[model samples]
Target: MSGPGTAAALWSALGSLPLAHLVPTGLGPWGDGMARLMLQPLDLLLLVALVLLAVQNGRSWSDRLALVLPLSWLVGGLGGLLVGRELHLALLCAALVTAVGVLAALEPALRLGKRFLRGGTAALSLLFGLVAGSSLAGHGGALQALLGEAVAIAVVTALLLMALDPPHPRWLALGLRLIGSWIAASGLLMLGWLSRQPL
Candidate 1:
């Protein structure tokens, strides 16, 4: 075909791509953005570390700390929704993940008071939630998007809690500690990447 005809055909094919395929399935633009933000590798890692930390304190699932963790996440999500600021959440979350992971790895050896650690965990949870929620504020239907993301976070956290219940065996406990180390390493790597970005 002539150059003009070939270019026209290519443009037509590109334009013909289905909107559903262009966007996330079931969730329109807002939902798509919310899902993308929540399901990021770093975000998922943070959630996993948070759940593990919540259960790692050698406390029962019914412990107040364990129970309050999810609530703190929700509150943070709400705070993020209200504040709607997209400033530096990735950096904040990375730092929190690093802190939480280090704490988890050291908890078995360190004699850090349980109350202090729990308080730190709760604060991190709120901040992480805020970061996650704030990321979704710029999308359409902000309220609905925030709620959807919060519910997803809650469900994942609940499942993790259930799976880790009944207390971990020695082998599993060791594995969790190792995972904590890995999370801390990942967070550190992320921090390094963030540092190189232009301000």
Candidate 2:
């Protein structure tokens, strides 16, 4: 088990690491990447929570999400691809999303500042991107997938921010909090499900 045998075994193990599959969209790699976000939606949930948090804080934060979020995600995804391994962070990520969701749900009461929102958005986006990139690392057209996801993120973030602009009415404000609560609950469910799996 020493020398070349061990080396070969180790190499084989690394080579066989599971690659994340893209849901086929009949649109090649790029389309598959775009479809991945909707099909696998933890990232979307986080994005929604962040947007809600931003809207609660100020318009400036919302605007920054459109720029900072996707860019940070892309950068982190690229780094993950370079690493070429799927991250086993589902549980941790679920916890993080849950925490963020709670923050969003309580945003009005907490009244977080603009700087906090900006930093939080960037950090979360990057971390999620890294996980996503790692998942896609060994797949064919990984770069295309990353780009597609990034574009989708940008488009979605912009549309959401536009639709949920500041000066929210009482009803819309309540709606945001409700959505945040749902995101948190979803994360908790995911955490429970993942935790139950046999390691």
Candidate 3:
């Protein structure tokens, strides 16, 4: 890799969960801002990829497990934005892990009869509920902060669900692409906003 490619690779790695989770704790103010912006694109990209993977692998338990990867990212990203650390949003992470494990454990049911997938469905539902609950509770009584976090989380989560569950496959894919593109654009806007913020 060279030039922008190298820079992009390094940034992407830095923004991954292990490193990104540590940034705010380890660095000063500027590092925190850089970490947030650097990770946004990765979340957006994974959102797009997971949507496509779910559609391609449709109705399979493996597809459901693939779905958890994006769910985890969405939870972690919004959780980080809202609460600023993985520890504050540990519930969300736990829910995601449970959902993924449930999906894996139910794979045989999906292949052989589909009864086992019920447990996975319940796990996912519970995860969703936990994520919603934590998000609402995270803002500590400020209306503006509460609304902003709720809207961001809902938009990202809804976009993922819609992408994975479009009634018409053709229109679904196209719609998800547009939504994912919009998310990428929004992330860019956030970067600009962060840059211009008073320090």
Candidate 4:
């Protein structure tokens, strides 16, 4: 039972378990990376929250988000790949997501200036991207998966920017805030779960 065959079997069994954040489809690493956006959707939620926050403020510089967010993310992710390990920062990440959600939900009241919003967006994106990259580092085709995820993020961000441009109608504005609250609630649930599970 303790032979090499048994060890190999144990390793295979461990690999089969869904412990990591990355979900693999049969469509290779790139596809897995792209699918990771939906399968593991914190990235998407953050992107949405950021977009909502940006559009609500109606700053001319908001246009830069389409470029700024993804580039910072890619750079952070590359740094993560170089580190080559996962960070056990579930609680911190959950808290950050919750805070961002709150910020998006309370955008009108907050009225953060252009400089703060721009800087905050880049910093948050970079941190999240680093976490994502760290998660993928231990997997096969990590670089490809990271690239695929980055591409997906860029496309989604661009599309969101296009759809949710400034001067939103009343209903659309309320809907964005509502979605932000939901994301915040989801983050809270995540925090509660992490508190109990400690991972």
* Candidate with maximal TM-score: 2
Instruction: Name the TM-score of candidate 2.
Output: 0.87
Kindly list the per-residue Cα lDDT of model 2 for residues 1-199, writing each as its tens digit: 8899998786655434433577777776788888888887788899888888988887766777899989999999999998888888888889999999999889889988787777778888889999999988877678888899999999999999999999899999999999999999999998999899922
Which ranges of candidate 2 are over 4 A from the true structure?
Answer: 1-20
lDDT tens readout by residue for model 4, 64-154: 8888988889888888887789877778878888998998888888888888989989999889889888887766567777888888888
The lDDT of each candidate is 0.67, 0.85, 0.40, 0.82
lDDT of each residue in 79-151, candidate 1, tens digit only: 8867866546677778778877887677667755667766776787688767766765544445555555555
- Show the lowest summed lDDT stretch of 10 residues, model 1: 14-23
Q: What lDDT score goes with residue 186 in model 4? A: 98
| TM-score ranking, best first | 2, 4, 1, 3
- Which prediction has the highest lDDT against the true structure? 2
Runs of candidate 3 exceeding 4 Å displacement? 1-53, 61-163
lDDT of 3 at 136: 34
Error of 2 at 145 (Å): 0.7
Model 4 earns a TM-score of: 0.85
Clashing pairs in 2: none
Spell out the clash pairs found in candidate 3.
Answer: none
lDDT of 1 at 126: 84
Q: How many steric clashes does model 3 contain? A: 0
Clashes of each: 0, 0, 0, 0
